[model samples]
Target: MAAEFDTLAEWTAQVATDLGSSFKIPAACRGSGSLAVLDWLIDELHLSHGGSLLDCGAGMGGPAAYAVRQRSVRPLLVEPERGACRAARSLFGHPVVRASALALPVGDDSFDAAWSLGVLCTVPDQLALLTELRRVVRPTGRIGLLVFVARSSEPFPHPDGNHFPTEARLLSLVEKAGLGIEDWRGTEEMAGPTPEWQSRVEKVTAELADRHRGQRAWQLAERQSQLIGQLLADSTVTGELLTLRRR
Candidate 1:
């Protein structure tokens, strides 16, 4: 198992600790998707107050926490990283399970809705991940995904641990996993982040640099961020937001 120290998880955990009691922690930890995207998905999922939600591959639990604050829904977070799980629990006081997306520890049909953001490309077994998500969600439940789909056949640089699928391939995999597409849209050109959101993120970034400058964990995380930014800038991959229903 990977140690908690000198990893992106450690950096994020430290950021949460440094930003203690500040409302910016959640905003700072929200991965690729912007606030607009989250709001749209939440509205589309039709999450009711007090309903159950499962956040698979939920790193640091920022989005899950945001959902809780917005809709008062009960969230069970499943994250694979140990340090991130700890951060989520300590920072947001949410129940988090350190587990893999391929085989969730939850019971069958345990959630009203589920979602995975910026996670599909990172997992090599995309089909199994989707299948597991389907198993845990009710037959009437919805599953939302924010994926980076390949836009062209030409080879382009991408961050390590990423295996982006073409749109057609992604659709086929969804069908294979017994999921029906309710709606899909492109988010590559979604509105920019709000000033407040940007500000929160900047503060966290500045703090991380000041605290862990030249550290191995910080260097690794910075490289990963740069690679992801390059992929987005080159137009080699496009963001796709899909709302799926169990068939």
Candidate 2:
């Protein structure tokens, strides 16, 4: 029988299953940005006990789980991939909804705050995603984002399914979406993973090698990660963290 996998979301789900109780370690390192980045956003969003948060495009429920763990907040995860949704439920026991960011299933003013990490580049309709966020979050609610902005107009190799926006274009989209910028920061270099984070990732990698070293799905996911790393390293893309308020 063929190995049951195709997308990076599947690979991430497998990793989450293998990690089991320690899933949050690698979970903290992936998708949501580093620990430092998460801290900044969580603090700026003012997440506290009993508060509600909506994680847009939450893959495998890593960052959302981390937020719940750190702040005791209630979290709802919105992910498009089925495998990821399943993994997120198993890994963190949080409510996972399989849906697109452009059209969330929840009602208006549903969440206290909303955030998307490393997800803006993947969606072509950036304005639509932001507008959806603005609608779901209450008026004056905060919306945090970690986006990879294009460094130049010159054509550059980017991972498949990505539509990175220039900094000016991203800002314009936020304004059109009815959100006002509250805080902005440029992360010139991605922060290095903490020691625990590195160790946890290595553990997952070792298990993957042991289980499916040469599988096509694994290779494809690895290639995608490498391509993204190269883009960040060569200054082809720059990371931008923004905190916006629903207007």
Using lDDT as the measure, the top candidate is 1
Worst 10 residues of 2 by lDDT: 1-10
Candidate 1 per-residue lDDT over residues 66-157, each given as its tens digit:
89888999999998988778777767888989899999999999999999998899899999999999999999999999999998756777
Q: Which ten residues in a row have the lowest lDDT in candidate 1?
A: 1-10
Q: Model 1, 83: alpha-carbon shift in Å?
A: 0.6
Which parts of model 2 are misplaced by more than 4 Å?
1-11, 188-191
lDDT of all the models against the reference? 0.81, 0.80
In order of appearance, the predictions have TM-scores of: 0.93, 0.92
Cand. 2 TM to true fold: 0.92
- Residues 157-237, candidate 2: write the lDDT tens digits: 888888999988997999899888999877654466788877787787677767766777767666777788888888789
Question: Can you list the residue pairs that collide in candidate 1?
Answer: none
